[model samples]
Target: MAKSDKKPGTRRDILNRLKSNGCSDATTLAEVLGVTPMAIRQHLYDLQSEGLVEARAEPRPVGRPAKLWYLTEAADRYFPDAHAELAVSLIDTIRSSLGENALQALVLERSRHQTVLYRNAMEDAPDLRRKLEALAEIRSREGYMAGVEETAEGLVFVENHCPICAAAKACTGLCAMELQVFADALGPGYDVSRTDHILAGARRCAYHVTERETVDG
Candidate 1:
């Protein structure tokens, strides 16, 4: 039997594309999704009416301008956030009741646990790519929207979204410890360093992984 053609709802797919790749125009979106431009525009109109998307005009080299569509802040409701409000509240309570040192201890403990879990998950993998893929799968299951990609620079681990954004903002130490956790989790010969940080006002978090002759971690 021939394979059936099926796909996600157009609106959801559009939102997801915008979330992953940032702003885009309907023509570009249609091409990527194998749909007609008119269909994409219709969905964009509905999304805009629902306050989930918006568009701004950009100058074109030979034409008037192009309408570039992008997700609005309100669209964040569609993505997983790992109970942001509750996480932030817990972070606040821990800091207020126990103090800074206690919070630091808590963050460190969390990092240690994460490192152990990641290391164990990647232990059976045969190579660096396999290990990174294992790590990506684990993180994706944890709501990070993570994946591993090969680029000109090196192997890159990309987290398109941070589900614990609120909690991380409440305690920056969580962010700091994450770097150490990654370095330790990947083991001795690999060096994992973050090149992009969402907390630092970037769209997402990305880490560069490179094999070194010797690594301190």
Candidate 2:
């Protein structure tokens, strides 16, 4: 939901704000965009009518209930999940024909292939931070809009977008495979586990990565 690929004052801009800031009112949105609250209200109304966003009332004790805007489940389609039409269709057909066990096996095979590709990109990353950075770069290249957060405990790998979300949802095994791939790529020096998943309704995919006993989060 970033504005990098979109111009200011567009629907994308509004959505990006709500995405990063959680639910917000028109005044807050106008202040952020330097626009009139009326203009922001129009945008919010349009988005709400389109079912992309939903507005809620928040009581402030004295004034009218403030209108807070947030994205609807339908808005998830606007995120990074691209290149998925054919992929999901093909996966659906495979699963329908081959059965669940075969699909799981297929996911494992695909994970191994992905692991190799990630390993190549991360092979030279010596430190824990470097490895996290390298993995983020690789994911960004694949349209995940990935980034790293350095905390006192460990490096948090956050992917704000998932380009293959449709495929992953069609087969949750894809998510499991991704966790395994991350662990393998980083080797035994670190433990990698997902704390947030977009499929589980989280805004992003977040991982708690611990390096040895020093970095735990």
Candidate 3:
């Protein structure tokens, strides 16, 4: 056989694959990474020993259960956090000295600013698909690892990673305002609903965006 030019996957690549695609068995991960299942299993075991990954038995009909590997909370250290500690500290400071109401005002202002920025970025996007693509690019640049998925019903905007997860946990207002920002950024005639939330124990955040019929007044 001829030599292959593709680079072999690293532990970080395995972590990233799990982060983006959720849980998977060693066999599946091996196939995706162009390596043998035994090699992948060894890597997974090493990661498990380091407390970065864990495996759960998934039931299989008429056969032994398969071990599904997934990233543990500790694995989050490998991903980008976008200055999580500083963001959380600022949130706490604002709420303590500026008051809860003032903190809320700041959140709203931040959402408004995001909405305007996103809108401006998507201004020339011609249609909903293009607009969603533009929005995903903007968010991915901001460390959300965002992408748009097309479905028969509509589009699913997926954020494979949340850089502000720490700040969002400290102040729930950030998540709420985020949903609002997405709605406003997409403009009218479209409804954006959060289908998954990382804070709620999901591996990633997903938004279902569908068009709503508008009747002329």
Highest lDDT scorer:
3
Instruction: Compute each candidate's TM-score over C-alphas.
Output: 0.88, 0.76, 0.92
| lDDT digits (tens) for residues 21-135 of candidate 3 | 9999998987788766777888899999999999999899979999999999999998899899999999999889989999999988888899999999988998888888999
C-alpha lDDT of residue 124 in model 3: 95
Weakest 10 consecutive residues of candidate 2 by summed lDDT: 1-10
95-196, model 1: which lDDT tens digit per residue? 899998999998888999999999999999998889999999999999888889899998999898888888888899988888889999988889988999
Q: Better model by lDDT, 1 or 2?
A: 1
Q: Name the best candidate (by TM-score).
A: 3
Candidate 1, position 54, lDDT: 94
Candidate lDDT (C-alpha), each: 0.88, 0.83, 0.89
Q: What local lDDT score does residue 99 receive in model 1, on the 0 to 100 scale?
A: 93
Model 1 worst lDDT run, 10 consecutive residues: 1-10
Candidate 3 segments exceeding 4 Å error = 2-9
Residue-level error in angstroms, candidate 2, position 58: 5.5
